[model samples]
Target: MMHNFNSDPFYLTRSHEFDWNGNESAGNGIQHVDSADITSLFSMHNGIKASNASGSLQFGGSLGQFEKWDDPIVADHTSNHNEKLVKLAQNREAARKSRMRKKAYVKELEMSQKRLLQLDQALEKARHQAAKQRHSIGRDDAFDRAHARWLGEHERLMDELRSSLLSGEGDDTTVHLLVDAAISHYGDLHGIKSKGAGSDMFHILSGTWTTPAERLLMWLGGFRSSDLLKVVEKQMQNLSLSEEQLVCIFNLQKSCQQAEDALSQGMEALQHSLTLTLSSSSLARPSSGDVVDYASHMATAMSNVHTIQSFLNQADLLRLHTLQQLQRILSPCQAARALLAINDYKARLRALSSLWLARPKE
Candidate 1:
């Protein structure tokens, strides 16, 4: 009962090479192990040996040979990665469009702000201009009323003078009344002009409220004193004026002319000084806060304007005084005749003005 050993079937086991621990590295294709890792390696090696005992292992001829197998987890991970790339591209495109829309909105907002600012500036300027025009119109209307009142009173006085003259050389009793009434009316008119002088000096001085014909004869809101003297002298020419009366007339005319020359020179000097002050500097451009001293210049200009207004008031006073002196120099009959001539001149000028205003225009 003997058995043959060579005829029995046998299994070949796979083996792995181990490497001992060194300073840094284990060479390729070797299991690297330190003294601490040796215990775990023995258990792992036993598991692999037991698994090999239960199954047959197939090996290719080459050491680098690899088997190709399809796994569900690997295929799913590839599909998910492709989907992520598509999602990332879409997100980038959406972000680009959002940035473009935001930029356009910002640009439009800037343009709208600029337009709104420009509109606001134009509206403010128009409002300012309208306010100034309204003030000018108000001044003109008030002056017009005053003139109407004076004309009505003056017409009554003229009628009285005519009646007295018709009664043969006029009465000495009414002469006092005539002279007093005339001087009082003129003083009232002068006072009205002076009241408006501070705010509307240029308009009052220019006599813009008067009719065009009256404006031609106007000097500081009334007729020039020298011109009045001329009227008086002409009226007295056919009268029996004495030597003393003639001398008084000559002296009055001389003084009025001298006063006018002095005021005129003062006005010219003021205008020259203001012109030089404005023209010599480079402040023509608008001020930027404290960069330019606009307040001081404004004060200086206002002072000059006030001085000019004072001169105009003085001229008005002189004209009133001259009329009073002329009335005093003449007798009642002679003074009444002079008043009549002056009224006639004024009536002729008004008639001329009416015609001029009604003339046709293109």
Candidate 2:
């Protein structure tokens, strides 16, 4: 019968001698294995064992167990993997830094844009102010030029009027009436009226007293008392003086003296006020307020001039009335002498006025 060792438990007992390399014999009728065959068998067993361990540890394993599979090739693969991870981390960091720099640059650009916008606005504002200032200056200059031209024209007209008066081209009576009418028109325009007869006389003297000293000297030269006295004496020889006439002459002299006194006082006051205003340092390049004040002063001076002119007209009327009265009272010879005296006085006055006007203002 054939031996059934596969089924016999005692056949493969632990005490039985066996040789894995087939270099030794078992205590049975087994054939001896060749050394080369034994080598092949051992190689097959190792290959099977390695395959089993690798398969078992495939999904999950400890670091030590994984390291057991380490060889030159495996080590090189790990090194390549680590290098790739390092490069990826470096790339991530570089990207992050780049993003940060980009953000900063964008912010800087935004700030620059805002700054440029502000500068543009500020420049525009400055330009506007400069333009406004230039416009204001232009207007002021134009007004000043116009005012100067008006003043020149006014002075020329005054000179012409003075020349006509000295030339005796017009009758004194007609001139006096015209002056009165002009003064009334002026008063109406300005809404000014005489407060009283005394004030009217005061205004007249004040206006005349303010005239430049040179003009006053020229006016004084016109009145020759010596010629007037000669004419008066001749008239007296022909006609006796009445009580009413003598009283009238005395009253006229008293009025004239009073007018002179008022004139002197008004001049003193006006000069003082003018000196204070003109000498002030602040008036040099007068401001708007200063200009207005100066204009007011000029208006006042002109009003005074008008008042004096009105008074002179009235005085002329009075003189004509007085002459008429004398003619009514005197004989024909006395009336003729009185007329001659009046003519001579008028001629002398005209000559004096001409001489005075010809003299330059000092």
Candidate 3:
């Protein structure tokens, strides 16, 4: 009889000899597996059978279970994410290095400008020293002329004494007379007191005592020596006045200093503003590699504007003040003469205008 093998326990297979396909014979002449019973056994095993399969059936020993799939598309997405992170890190490092380099460049430029200013100051000092030396040389020349004249007069007196004595006409009276006259004449020529205990060469040369020598040199007429002295004193007064002229020059110097101060302050303000702009742009925008070039152009324009404004406002004020001071110090005619010699205000204004026009526009 045909039995239901799907639900029959006799249809179950526990060895490779189980006739899953119902083709094997039992030990007795009765067929052990019915079609319905075998179907029940297959259904009980979830439609899987170990026998009558072409290939060996794998049974959950490190295989034959649903696999956890490794998706290639997901792996590509993770790789791209890591690459972007690395690129961002590299960009950050480059930007930091560029900022450091720009800072170093600006510092170096400031140092160079400071050194140039010091050099200018040193040069000015050297010129001042040279002027003083020149004045000193003029004084020395005047002193040398006076000393030579005194020495020549002394030699002449000695020659006269020797001739008179060799001619047998010199007596104690002559010697005394000659010595008295020599001393008197020396005192008067050099403006020394005849009654002084003694006098050195310098005191005799510079002393204002000419009465005694004038009386002794009566035979030579009242030598115009006093007139020569008056002239010398006048020259010394003129030298002193040169110092006054130099004081007037200080007006110009003060003007220059004020102009430079104004220019420096304006430029410093502009530099600060430019630094702020650069910092803001760096932080607010993505790196586009063109910020540096644009920033440089803007910085140059700002610096020029600051410099021009300083010259227009502060330098013009200083220049006008200096001009007023100069006018007060010099007569109208003298000022015109001097200004004409130097090409005058019109030329100066023209030159300034030309320079301003040549500068780049904002």
Candidate 4:
């Protein structure tokens, strides 16, 4: 009575030698099972266990065998995703920094504009006040005395230079001292003019220190340095200058001319700007019923005029440098001659002014 179940997973089969009473052992103790069948049964049992543990076979191999096959692909996808996240973060940070820079730049620009406006207003107010009152802009009695003293010194030095020239081999030391003094003396005039630039802006801007004849030749705020070079050249013609000296003079003249041209252009532009500022109808736009901002307009005009002082300063420096350089190029006697030539030219202008003034008027 052994069971025969071939459909079962265990594949148990009954022994063919068993009797109906299940007493195969009645005659021969027990029926002997085939060793090959036992072996096949145990092999099937082990195969089913492997299939259960690994969730069935796949393409003739266990499921675990293919598990590592997709691991490399998953790892690659994860790495790519991390890199994208890093790039996105970098882009966001860059955008944030750029926005911050733009904001700061705009803020600074606005602040600068505000400060510039304030400065202009103060200047305009100061100029207006100066017109109503007498301010000591370095033009006190002491300055007048100093100016007179400077003129006398100029006369004395010129006389000494004349005496030195009349003597044989003119005093080189006197010539050197004269040039040095001339150069140094400009500082006093420059300082006085600078003081007046802010307090008496119009007077300094005009040829206030010059006679009418001198003013006729005035450029910017004073005489052009190039004109002085011409005088020096004319005076040295009798000296029979060497090629090097002439070339040096010509080069200096060219440089002075170029500088004058540049300053002229700048001054023209500044004049245009000042004209617009001064003549702007915003200060008197009552007809339009719009509120006028007088301070703003005046400030702009004052600012432009203030820049004229800087141009005057540069022109003064050019004249000083021209004289100093010319001194270097000329011999002591030649320099004395140049100095005398300049004085004579000035005297001639004064004579012309005197004759013009004395002319019979209708």
Candidate 5:
């Protein structure tokens, strides 16, 4: 049979020379083939028979011909193949999310490490600062201790100096005499000149007195003079003694009438006394005891000057005389000059002696 069916060109077709049954004969007259028999023959036959019995024939399956198709149908097959592509894309997106999360985790760890490093640096700096502060405190404490020790030593030295000056002991009679002389001069302030540059006995002892005791004694005598003078000035001011009143009070002892005559007589008398005393001392050498007694009397006389009993202190006058007598006896020695310096004894002697020499009336 030869038939043409054309709904789709890809459907099967039958040719005239092809055989339907398993026979060598071709159909002679119009054969009445049942549809069922034809269907059965189509099922049993394969290859050439299957090709001939088909209504319209194609050489291969649609899948086999698909290779020769145009882009549209080819794209349809490619589209079907790409179904798994969506799954691949979803997997790639998941991997990307995982990688991004890993990077973010790594960054966080780096930040944490950096922060730890910063903390360590801060801790080290704080430790160094604390150490420096401790060192500074130690240095300050050391300085304070040294200063305290220095002050203690200074105070000890000053105490020794004060003690040495205060203690009156030693072997220099001439220096002692100088000291007594200084004390006498100071004691005479109220009666004599109230304020003068007034000698510092310490300077005089160091400069003038050869005797050790006398020098030390002289220093002791004047050590408190500057201080005493302050006290006296304060007392006098409190008493409201005017400057003119002070001058008048001082002049009273020198206000005797027949002034020039009295002065001449007095000077002559002082010179005579000096000559007599020197002559006697040269003949009779004095004992050390006599010299010592003379120093004591000189001290006593000086102490009595300008005291409350200045005019009527008979004991003080006797001490003055006794000191003069002893000084005369010791005049042969060089140390005798130290005694004479006391109370201006040498001058008094010279004036008395001169008076005797020039005396017209006995």
Candidate 6:
């Protein structure tokens, strides 16, 4: 029947012979059917029966051809989607790491700010302490200068007396009595006894007095010239300090003392304040604005310290002027010695001032 169908050109039909169990026997002929006839067969068969019979019929191509047509397009689409997913995951991880790095940088900046603030505060405190020490040294130098001037005057007087006695032109008995009284008075005042009781006057006249305070007082009390004493006394009376001037001088002394104490206390307070600022947990993390405020406060405090120092310097100048005026009443040699002493003291003070000024600040 298949040979007859194949021999006919217009219609081709191929049939499969099936056993009674409805299964096709081997080699019972797979064959091509015409499209119209296959359509009619499909119309007669239900969907399940058609699918089962599909293998027996010949189509244009096998099922593998359809899969081959779609495979490259589907594979390209899947490759592109997988690449997109991989790129998206990489970008997400990168973004996360970038955020972590940014957070670390911010933390480092915060720590740096805190460290700088601490350094600034420490520098300010060091400056305050240095200023305080400078003022204290200035006060001490002033006192030393005054005392040196007194000692210089005493040495000058001793020299003058020794010269007069050695010349042997003065009243010998009166000079001897003056020397004895001066020595006794000086010893009593200084709580010191002359080492060589009998030779003390001779030693002083020979310019060999070794005790500084005793030598100074002996000079002070040894001047027995009634004429010179009268002249000095009259001059002193003429230049008698007014009650108001005396009070001012006394008040200046008190104020200087108080300023010294105050400066000491102020330095302590400044240190305490800085300690609190640096050591406090809350203040240790100060912001930019807080740092600015602290700097301003330190500037104000430094200004006040300078003002006090200026006043102290002015007071010292006035005291120096007063000493100069008093020294004028002494003999030329004595006055010159006193001035030299003052100059020496001033030199020392200048050296100290220079040292303080040159000290390195934080």
lDDT of each: 0.73, 0.48, 0.47, 0.69, 0.39, 0.46
- Tens-digit per-residue lDDT, 1-362, candidate 5: 55543332233323233344424455344434555655555654453355555533323422121122346878788887798798899999999999999999999999999987866666455445443543454233333333345435534433333333346442345444543443343244222211111322222213121122223333211222222223333444434555664564334212322332343355455446545544554235446447765555445444433231222232223333333333332322222232323323323433343333333444
lDDT order, best first, reads 1, 4, 2, 3, 6, 5
Candidate 1 lDDT over 1-362, as tens digits, reads 55433453322223343333214343344333444455555655675566567553223222222233357899899999999999999999999999999999999999999987866666455445443543576575566567668778989988877887787655687766876787788888788778767657888887766667888988766788898778767877765799998998899899999998898799899888777656644445436564456656666777887888998999889988888888888887777777777778877776666555544457
Regarding lDDT, does 1 or 5 come out ahead? 1
RMSD of each: 29.7, 34.8, 35.9, 25.6, 37.9, 31.5
> Which TM-score value belongs to model 4?
0.56
Model 3 residue 307 lDDT score: 50
Instruction: Return the lDDT, model 6, position 332.
Output: 38
| Model 2 poorest 10 in a row by lDDT | 57-66
Looking at model 4, residue 361 earns an lDDT score of 60
Best by lDDT: 1
Q: Give the lDDT of residue 18 in candidate 6.
A: 61
Per-residue lDDT tens digits of candidate 4, residues 121-204?
Answer: 654554444322323454343334444576677777778777767875546786677656665665566666566565655665
- Backbone clashes for every candidate come to 0, 0, 12, 2, 30, 0
**Candidate 6 local accuracy as lDDT?**
0.46
Clashes of 6: 0
Best by TM-score: 1
Model 2 residue 161 distance off true place after TM-score fit, in angstroms: 30
Minimal lDDT window, size 10, model 5: 189-198
Candidate 6 lDDT over 1-362, as tens digits, reads 24665455345444666665558766545466666766665654554355446533332322211112336888899999999999999999999999999999999999999987866665566445544653453233333333345556545545555565557664645454444443333333222212222223233222222222223323211211222223333333334545654454444445544544554476466546655545554344457458766665556555654443443333333333434343333433333333334334433443454444444669
Off by over 4 Å in 1: 1-138, 280-282, 289-292, 360-362
Candidate 2 similarity to native, TM-score: 0.29
